[model samples]
Target: MTRPLTVALVAGGALLARRALRRRIGASPLWPMPALEEPVSGRRRENRRPSSHRVLVAERTEPAEGVVRLRLEGADLPPWEPGAHIDVVLPSGAVRQYSLCGDPDDRGAYTIATRVLEGGRGGSRELRERLHEGTEMEIRGPRNRFPLVAAPSYLFVAGGIGITPLLPMVRAAERAGADWRLMYCGRSRASMPFLDELEQAGADGGRVTVVAEDESGPPGLAFLGGLPAETAVYCCGPEGLMDAVSGALGEARAPHLERFTASAAVPGGAFALELRRSGRVLTVPADRSVLSVVRDELPNVSYSCTQGFCGTCRQRVLEGEIDHRDELLTDAEREDSMLICVSRCRGGRLVLDL
Candidate 1:
């Protein structure tokens, strides 16, 4: 069952369409990818303590070069939607987010994959070097920011390991019999994970287009602007690729984006922060993040990704207006809480439930 049930099944002389999509991860060549954080875009949230579950790494395999897929088995595991991501708490207490590239129908286990970033942060390197089968770890959230919506048609663009999140979306789109096209890009065909499965999915027609850099110079995105107004476009990959797709779309439409890293926030004015419980007041400089200033006051503040996508630095706002910046939180979440990493205060002062 490690091979995701991407293909549909027929029974009783009728077609049985499953709602869950076949999730897969492809490890591509050594692309200059900084962070493979899940697609945390169009994120909606409600304030709740997302529970953490204990799981054991039941199996490990190399789906492609520079990639490792881990099947974590846990009894009565929670179900996840397409484009959902789980937060892994490493042995070093470093938290990293990864997309769930497994059959959501199989709730007993969860599958995720990662690409080793040799020159970047140690999160992926730790997963590759330190983790193995039989190892126990903790996972959190199963939160979905990049959810597949009901669209007239879909145009999915994935680059390198960025295909992780879109895998489930592609599956769901096919199952729904929606008009969808996928442009999967990577370093080479040999390095792309789940190529055979994708090829098979699109075998009946030309639904999937593979763009290997070695074979194709670069992806031509001018056609995106020519798409129909009803087409829902989704793009996940390197910042430059996503930016290019956005650029091509121009004023026609804004494609739903899944980012590996956090987006840069505009520079806002400095403000004073009052930690209610800690009885501390700090000034958040315009140039620095609120997290940097808060950490100085309380050295052990729990935070990861420091870019606001992870929501680790979220603090309840007791008073004052917030200059919200992160894409991970929703409108309701902005009512009482704010991600201290990038968000700031609209007023000159504020009170926080730290």
Candidate 2:
């Protein structure tokens, strides 16, 4: 098993708010977006898939305490949907993913935000220190595994920095004239990003519930039971909140949500692992993860968020039927690559590209 992460804040969830509203969704009636694995921009995934592009840190701002918003600018950038995210490759070789929170119509740049977790992983700290206005770095993808779909109505719930992804969705829902509401919760009002914007946007039309644990206890999620199942619920927040909502609504009526952390399942028996590059054979015991065992021999292997939410630990599969356990990878990515931090062999031995 991976070691326990000392995440200080109560924000313990992955960015997993993927609710395909089961119909065509568009910001305006002019552009009718179809509900599919990709956006309705007519850009094919493989044909337009870019390598890495150098982007300048054009702008940076602290929207809230411990949260940084960066505007990475480049020329003729690819278009993205509301829930898309990009992989930021750092100078230190550490890779981190951030949801694109900016306007999708603005194709010249991408905007992303992150919250620094004290005593947690090091990516956010490195990003804050190394990145500055005019600094150039390589970034890949505006990949969308969580694109917004057409729904009769939407209920957006955000926790702390989790609002990054939902911000665009809220805007789209509002602009599209679809029925929607927001429930934004955080440690305090000062800790929540995009608070004023969300409040202003939701002020005249719909409900925008702001629950601060400092003043009010945990907000009651029991109202989910009364809502129509057709109401597409998009939730991105703490793990406990997601669990509470899911438990109350049940799996059949599951709320669409996102996670910032990995959820490890029951480990199977021991298995053999083959590293084709380094020519090393290792045994991954039942209680351990493949990442822990491989790191012993190959100390320089890149890894962050050992929970498997980040794509840093992904490796090519030379051979083996992998028991995939990560939410970071899409169906196409899972065809050959697997996140070593959580995935394991189905049975017997597995071969990797090291």
C-alpha local distance difference test of each model: 0.78, 0.78
Superposition error at 344 for model 2 (Å): 0.6
Model 1, 120-145: lDDT tens digits are 77899999988899999998878777
lDDT for predicted candidate 1 compared with the true structure: 0.78
TM-score of each: 0.85, 0.81
What stretches of model 1 exceed 4 Å from their correct place?
1-47
After superposition, candidate 2 runs with Cα above 4 Å error: 1-50, 274-282, 292-305
Give candidate 2's error at residue 303 in angstroms: 3.9
What 10-residue stretch in candidate 2 is worst by lDDT?
9-18
Best by TM-score: 1
**Candidate 2 per-residue lDDT over residues 1-354, each given as its tens digit:** 111211121111111111222233424422346546655385323322325788999999999999989999998788887888888888887777789999988889999999987776688898888899999998988777676765566788788888998999998877765567788889898999999998889887446888888878677776777666557778888898878768877767877777777664866889999999899999999988899899999988778667766677888887889898886787777877888889999989999887
